[model samples]
Every structure is written in structure tokens, then in C-alpha cells.
Target: MKAAMIFDMDGTLFQTDRILEASLHDTFQLLRDEEKWEGDTPLETYRDIMGVPLTDVWKTLLPLHPTHVHERVNDVFQDKLIQNILGGMGALYPHTEDLLSYLAERGFPIFVASNGYPRYLETIVEYYALDRWIISSYSIEDIDSVDKGELIRKVKADHHLSHGIVIGDRRSDFKGAEANEFLSIGCAFDFSQENELREADVVVDDLIEIRDYLEKVK
Candidate 1:
């Protein structure tokens, strides 16, 4: 049976922790300079909220400030994030290009299924020239919700894929795969809680492990 491999973008394919943290820091500072907030929220405190939508982030943080202040802050934060991406400030994880190329050479049907915004996904794929390696890409914009499992199911149906797997750094990735009866591989090199990683069908700390697993499954 042919196998389709879908990967998550943020912590899975690219190491955006620093970039995101820095962007948030710049955004909060900009808000403070504009007198939008009296103080800054630490980046560490916001790490758990990283993959969440911007609108949700605003809603969560808005309680700390007047409701009238959230709209402007959200606008400024988004502007700064866009600027950061366009400024050539972000980077992919180590060995990502090599791993992707390896999969492409092996004729694997590889796709990027991510919760990231569509524009950001487009920018990163173009910037990395990943179009050559990836068969397709999907973002949260393609779906109405952030449920990764639902997105995987949609991909499976749309592509007519019968067998496949998901590789990601979060427990939701594994749960999504399980929901669709697909194998889940947790990436240990990326950020994930220990309990979350334990739920994966397999766990690996390197890309070569994925290549090996694919071979065994085939």
C-alpha cells in the first residue's frame, strides 16, 4: 500500500520558538510604547498559547486590559508578526531540507498539514523552496476549526489516500491520526510534553528514524 506522510509546520518542520517569542516581545513592546498596555507579558508565559489563533490570543489577553484596547493591540501584533516573517528573520529546523529531499527522492507523497495561517505557510514554503519536495500543503484557513484530526480526515478524503501517517510535536497530532486510524509519529527533537509524546505510535529524535520507519511500514 502507498503511504502518505503529513507533517506539522511550526515545531515539527521549523523551529519557530525563538522567532515567535521575539515577535511577541516586539509586539508587546510596541503596544507599551503606544501606551496600549502598562506592562509586558513574558514570552515564557505565552508559550503554551503559541499555536492558538491570534483572535483567541487576543481574547485571552484582553481581560488584562480594557476591551476597547484589544482590537488595536491585536492589529499591531499581527503587523509585527508579518513584518518579522517578511524580513527574513525566521528559520527551519536543522536537517529539515535534507529530510524532505530524502522523502521526495523516495517517491513519498509528502504534505504539510499545519495550524499556521495560510499566508505564513505560503511564505515559509516559498522561502524554503519546499514546493519541489512537498506534494501539497494545507493550513487552518482550509478548515473551519483548529482540530488537527479533522484536517487530517479532510486531507485523506480529498486526496483519496487510504493509508498514511502524521508526524508532529503535539499530542493533538497523535490524537488526530488515531481518529483517522493512521499511524502517529511524535518528534522528540521538537517541543512536546512527555506524556503527549508517549501517546504516539512511534517516537523518534531524528529524521532518519522516519525514513527507517517508512521503510519498515512499507
Candidate 2:
């Protein structure tokens, strides 16, 4: 069987940071209005928490807040994120569509493994028409697990995949593939720190490079 491709949504395929800033601003405003948050913003930026699970994101941003507060923030942030996505406030990275089409044409089965919420994942796939190229997508919300490695195992079993590659811009993505004994291709042009992708089997500077590398290896 052809090797499948599992992608991470945030910094790998979808340019989430583009929409997240606006959504975060709105969420902070709402929280202030309702007296849920004390300050104008959290000490750390969203970039600092990128590629981690949502619960960890909450822990990082609201270390002193309770579970209910985190849930409330998540709800508001997700609402705003979906609105921005539908409104065309974000985009896939340059050459991403072309790369996906290239892989699709070669009969590579593509899937998404993300830490995003259910509605957030649905909106992204539908709005971007990613279902056209992707065989299926899975998120932490779907599996009720924070570990991307476990998430990868679930996808592989459910889809009956035997061989595959993991692609993303973070250490979690590389670690997931490593745990599954699959090759990992890290996208270096996105949100990850310089050393974050050191463990990746391969590193790429652009989306088109992914296509080129895969073609040579396939």
C-alpha cells in the first residue's frame, strides 16, 4: 500500500495564527466585559503555546484560573475562530493547495491529526474544501486524548493504514511519528522553535518542498 500522509492543522497546513490573534482579542474583550479575566491579556502570547494540547494551552495562559474558566474561554475562542474562518479571515499556507493536489493525484491518502476542537476542525475542513484532498481528519476532540502519538495510532488502526509519514511544524508532530515508527517531515517555515524539529526525519522550508521530497522518496 502507498504510504499515507498525516498532517497537523495549525502551523503545517492551516495558517491558524492569522485568525487566532483576532479571535483572541475578541475573546479577551468578552472576558473583560463579563469580568471573567482580570487583565488586558495574558503574560504569554498564543505562539508560546502553539502545538500543545488545549488543556495545556489553558494551563499556560490561565495558570491560576479554574477548569470552568478555561472551558468558558475555549467556548468563546472557538466561536470567534469559527466566525473568522467562515468570514475568510485566515488561509492555508502558500502552495499548500498545489502540494495537496500533487499528493492526491499520486493516490496518497492524506489525513489530519490536530489538537483543535471539533467545531473548529469541521469549519476548517469544510471552509477550505480540504475534504477534497483528505481521506479523513481526526482531532483531540474526536479521540478525547491529548497525546498526538495515541491519536496517530487511532487513525492508523481505524483507516487500516500500515505505512505512513507524519507532517507538521512542531515537536509533537515529530514525536508522534517517532512513537509510531514512521518517518516525519517537519515544516520549518511555520510556528515551531528552531530546535523543535531536530528530531524530524526530514525538514522542509516550504509546502512545495514537501511535494518534491515525497516524490523522490515515493
Candidate 3:
């Protein structure tokens, strides 16, 4: 089978900073108005924890709150996020659609494997018309994934994918690719820290640079 292309949605394909900050601001306002939240929670905190699991996100964002409060906060956040996404509050990285189309046209099995919520992934794909190229997409929440590694494995198993490259901007992407024996392509143009992509099989400074690497693999 041809090699698949598994992409991380948040910081890789999608530029989520604006949408997430706007949604978090809205979520905090609604909760505070409802007397559920009482502090100034900056959006940077949420940004730093973007690629982690939702459970971890809540733990960090609402460390002092109880589990029920966490669930409530998450519900509000998810709702606000969806609203923002539909409102056109975010954008994909430059050339994101072009690259996907290029690969898909050449018979690549493209997929999105994200640590984000299922609805979030689905919303972006549907709203941005990414479904035109993506064969399938999966989220950690949808499959009860432990991390990006398991998420990748699940996509591979479910779709009968044998070979692929994992693309993202975080350590988990490289770690997951290593664990699954897939080549890792780390995107440096997004939210990655310095040296974060050091372990990646191939590190790219821009979305378009990925095309060069794919040529060798192809």
C-alpha cells in the first residue's frame, strides 16, 4: 500500500492560537457570569498545554477545581470553541490545503490524528472543506487514546494503513512516530519550542518544505 500521511491538527495543520484564545475568553466570561469561575485565567496557559489530553488540560487550567467543575468548564469550553470555529475564528497554516491536495491527488492516504476532541476535529474538517482530501480523521476522545502514539496506531489499524509519516510540532509527535515505527516530520513553523523537533526524522521550517522530504520517500 502507499504510505499514508498522518497530521496533527492543532499546531500542525491548523493555527489554533486565535480560535482557542477567543473561545477560552468566551468560556471564562460565561462561567464567571454563571458564578462558576472566579479568577483570571490567561489564554497563554491553555496555549502551552494545547497538544496534551483534555484531562491534562483541565488539570492544569483548573488545578484547584474539583472534577465536576472540570467537566462543567470543559463543556462550556467545547461549546464556545465550536461556535468560534463555525464563526471562522481560525485558519489553517499557509499552503495547508494546497499540500493536502497535492498529496491526495497523487494517491496518498491522508488522515488527521489529533489529541483534540472529536467534535473539534470534525468541525474543522467540515468547515474548512478538508474532507475533500482527508480519507479519515480520528481524535483521542473518539478512540479513548492514551496519547498521540495510540491515536496513530488506531488510525493505522482501523484503516489498514501499513506505512506513513507522522507530522506535528511537538515531542509527542516524534515520540509517537518512533513508537509506531513511522517516519516523523516535525513542523517548526508553529508552536514548537527550540530543540523540540530535534528528534524528528525530518524537521521542516515551513509547511511547503514537507513536499521536498516527501519526494525522497515517494
Candidate 4:
């Protein structure tokens, strides 16, 4: 059977914890200085909710704040994220480049299926030049169902694949894979909690483990 692999961007492929945390703090402080914030924000709370959709994230993290405030705050956050990107704040996890190279060397097709903002995904892939190994990159903006599984289905059809898998670090990622009947490989080295990672068909602490497991499966 022909098979392909789909990867999530933030915690899966890129170690964005530090950059996200720093940018989020900057966003909150800048807004507070402007008198837009209701109160101080919890850093880890924001980090814990990282994988949720952007709109939902502000709603969950700052429900007491006005919705418009959340929107403006998010704009500042994304802007700072872009600045940090320019400052060289994020990088791929250990073994990520080597793993992608290995997969590409063997003619294996790999694609990004992330819930991250379309531009964020685009920037990271382009900045890292991951396109050389990645068949294509996808995000919520490109799919109609607004579900990663649906995105996976579309990619599957586009490539005429019989099987595909999701590699990510969150519960939603595993849920998307299960909903589509694809293997879910939880990446445990990043931000996800233990309970969330348990949803995956298999959990691995390193990217190379994914390559090794797939090699055995193939």
C-alpha cells in the first residue's frame, strides 16, 4: 500500500516553546501598557493551550477580557512572533532535519498538516527550507472542513495514497488521525501533557524514532 506521513509544525517539527512564551509575554505586557489588558496573563496557562485554534485560544485564556481586546492582543502576539522569527528564535527539534532527509532519500512522501496559522506554517517551512523534503504544507486555511483529518483526506486524494499518518504533539492531532482512521504518532518531547499524548497509536520522544518505527512498519 502507498503511504505518506503528515506532520504538525509547532511542537512536532519545530521547538517553538521559548519563542512562543517570550512573544506571548511581550504581547500581554505591551497591551497592558496600552491599557487594553484587564490583568496579568499566566504564562504557562497560555503555553498549555498552545495547540488550540487561535480564536479559541484567546477566548479560553482571557475569557474575562473583551473579545476585541483578545483580537488586538493576538495581533500583537503574532507580530512579535514574526519579529522573533526574524531574530532567529525557533529551530527544528533534534534529528528533525536528518529524519526528513532520510525520508526524502528513500522517496517517501511527507507533508505538513498543522493547525498553526497559515502564515506561521508558511514562514517556518520557508525559513527552514523544509520544502526540499516536504511534498506540500497545509493548514486550517487550505481545507474546507477545518479539521486536520479532512486536510489529510484531501492530501491523500491529491497523491493517490492508500494510507497516511499524523505526527504531532497534541490531543487534537491524535483525534484527527483517529477520525480519519490513520496512525497517530504522538511526539512526547515537546509541550503536550501525558494524558493527551496517550491518545496516539504510538508515542515517541524523538523524531528519529518516528523514522525507525515507519521503517519497521514498511
Candidate 5:
């Protein structure tokens, strides 16, 4: 059977923790400058919410804050994040390019199925010149849904893929793949906890493991 591989961006293909931390700090500073919020919360506190939706982060951070203000904060944060990435502030995970090239050279269809906004994903892909290796892509905006499972299903349908695998670094990524009937591979080298990685069909600590898994499956 032919198999395809879908990957998540943030904590999967790229280790953006430091860059994300800086962006959130800048975002909060922007909010403070605009007199939108005056809280004692630090950037580290928001780090845990990085891979999830921005509104979810706002809800968790400022539950009592007004909805409109929360939306505005997310908007500002997204804008700042784009600017930061465009200014050469982040990097791809170690061996990311190697992995993508390995898969592409083997004639395995590869695409990115991420929870990030389409524009941001596009920017990152273009910045890294990853389009040459990635055959297709999908994002949260394309599905009009934040649920990763639904996004995965949409990607599968769009690509006309009957069987595929998902590689990511979060529990939700694994859950989404399982929910959509795809084999899930967790990348422990990124930043997921043991329990989260356990949700995947397979857990890989390095790109070598991913390559091995693909070979075995093929």
C-alpha cells in the first residue's frame, strides 16, 4: 500500500520554544503599552499553551478578561509572531531538513498538517525553502476548525490519501492521527512529555528512528 507522511510544524519540525517565548514576551509588552492588560503573569507561564490555539491560550490566561479584548490580544500576538519569524528569529528542528529530504527522495508524499495559521505556515515554509520537499500542506484556517483531528481529516481528503502517518511532538497530534485512522509517530526529541508521546502508535527519539519506521512500513 502507498503511504504518505504528514507533519506538524511548531514543536515537530521546528523547536520554536525560545523564539516563541520571545514573541510572547514582546506581545505582552505590546499589550501593556496599549494599556490592554496589567497583570503579573510572565512569559514562562504562557509557554505551556504554545501549541494550542491562541484563543485557548487567552481563555486560560485571562478567563475573566473581556472576550473582545482577548480576541484583540490574540490578533496582536499573531501579528508580532509573524514579524518575529520574518525578521529571522526562529529555526527548524535539528535534522528536519534531512528527514524531509529522506522521505521525498524515497518517493513518499510529504506534507505539513499543522494547527498554525496558514499565513504563518507559509512564511515559515518559504523562509526555510521547505516547499521543495513538502508536496502539500494544510492549516487551521483551511478547516475553520481548531481541532487537530478534523484538520487531519481535511488534509487526507484534500490529498486523496487513503493511508498515511502523522509525525508530531504533542499528545493532540497523536490523538488526531489515531482519531483519523492514521499511524502516529511521536517525536520525543522535540518537547512532549512521556505520557503524551505514549499516545502515538510509535515514539521516536530521533530522525533516524523516523527513517527506520518509514522503511519498515514501506
Candidate 6:
């Protein structure tokens, strides 16, 4: 592939917030009785940490908890999240499949780069049949740094891509692309809020618009 279209999975492709919140809450309940859990199960504080790794997420959610406890909660959270997705609890954004098919048929090299775990990313791709279009997937679990920029660069270099675009819904995604001087398109419809995507090269409200926009730029 000469160029790749790297996309983020969570808010950009999968409509995951609502379903994931439920999974987080469910996992918290399992970790501690409802009465003792003290903090809000579906803590809105999580809103700012969407693109972070789960290990850090657990620390942020429960600083007083031990590492073992955090690990246990993360394990259960992943399990619950996988179950929720398997049960058809989450849905993809509108036109996501059609757009993927359109890009694939046109021979655009596509990849999903996320901060999510390997299993979770696989589950989403398999569940939504996105594996048909995506050439590969990458996650923070595969990297030593929580910084997605490094992962983004690896995807770009490993594919021998001299020109590529990154599409995502977080500040880190925008920063990654900007840091590497790659084309960046920020999705404004999902988790991205109030200038969160200010660093992006371009921003679009509808996912389908990406195809149109890219065609013009190309």
C-alpha cells in the first residue's frame, strides 16, 4: 500500500460511549458492592480520558485501590464490554459500512488504530464485519507508550506509506497526525467536543463526508 487511511475505532467508527459506560458500571458493581463503591459507577469523569489505556483509566477511577484490584476491575471490565458487544448492545455510526465498502472497493488501504485492547478491537471488527475492509489493526496494548503518536507512526512506516491520513475523534489523534505531519481529519460528531479537535488539519461532522473530502484533496 502506498498510502493508508488509518481510523480510530471507538468514537470514530463504533458508537461506544453509551454501551461502554454501562459495561464500566457493571464491572464496578462486580468489584465492590453498590453501597461501598462510593464513586459513581459510570463516572462522567471518564469523559476526558476516553482515548487512554485501561490501566491508567483504572488508576484515575480509583487512586486508593491496589494494583491487583485495578487489574481485577480491568479484567472484569473487558469481559463485560466484550459480552455487551457480543450481545449486540453497541452499534456502528451511520454510513460506516457503506463508507468502508466504498473505500475498500476503490482500493484505499484502511487500518484501525486504537487505544483499545487487542481483543476488544478484534471483537468490534469481527462483530461489525469491518474485517472485510480493514487491512490490519493496532492497539496501545501492543505499544510501550500510551502516546498514540508512536503507534500512528509505526502504522505509517510499516506499510511503506509516504502519504496517509488519520481519522479520529480525540485530541491525541489530532496531535499524533499533526506531530507526524500526516493529514488529519477530526470527527466532530462523537466524543470530540469544543475545540478538542482544534489541532486537526480538517474536521468534519459526518463520517461519510470523509470520502468526499479526501477525494477532493487527493
Task: Name the top lDDT candidate.
Answer: 2
Q: What TM-score, computed on C-alpha atoms, does each candidate reach?
A: 0.87, 0.95, 0.94, 0.92, 0.92, 0.94
Per-residue lDDT for 145 in model 3?
A: 58
lDDT of 5: 0.81
Better of 1 and 3 by TM-score: 3
Tell me the tens digit of each residue's lDDT in model 5 across 1-218: 35788899888887677477777777778777887669754666566565687668789877877999888877877787788888888888778888888888888898888878778888889889999899877887787688989988988888788988999988888888998899999888645778778788998887667888767865
lDDT of 4 by residue, 1-218 (tens): 44578898888999888588788889888877887676766778867876777777888877888888888887888788877876899888999999999988887789988777777888888888999999888887677665667777777778787777889998888988887778899999668889998889999989999878977977
Candidate 3 positional error at 40, Å: 2.5
What is the C-alpha local distance difference test score of each model? 0.79, 0.87, 0.85, 0.83, 0.81, 0.85
Worst 10 residues of 4 by lDDT: 140-149
Candidate 3: clashing residue pairs, number: 0
Ranking by lDDT: 2, 3, 6, 4, 5, 1
Maximum-TM-score candidate = 2
**Positional deviation of residue 95's Cα in model 5 after best superposition, in angstroms:** 0.9
Error of 1 at 175 (Å): 1.3
State the TM-score for model 1. 0.87
Q: Candidate 6, residues 98-212: lDDT per residue as tens digits?
A: 8899889888899988999999999999988898999999998777888889999888778877878899998889888877778888998657875788878889888899879
Residue 52, model 2: Cα distance from true site in angstroms: 1.0
- Report lDDT (Cα) of residue 42, candidate 4: 74
10 residues in a row with least lDDT, candidate 5 = 40-49
In candidate 3, residue 173 scores what lDDT? 89
lDDT of 3 at 60: 91
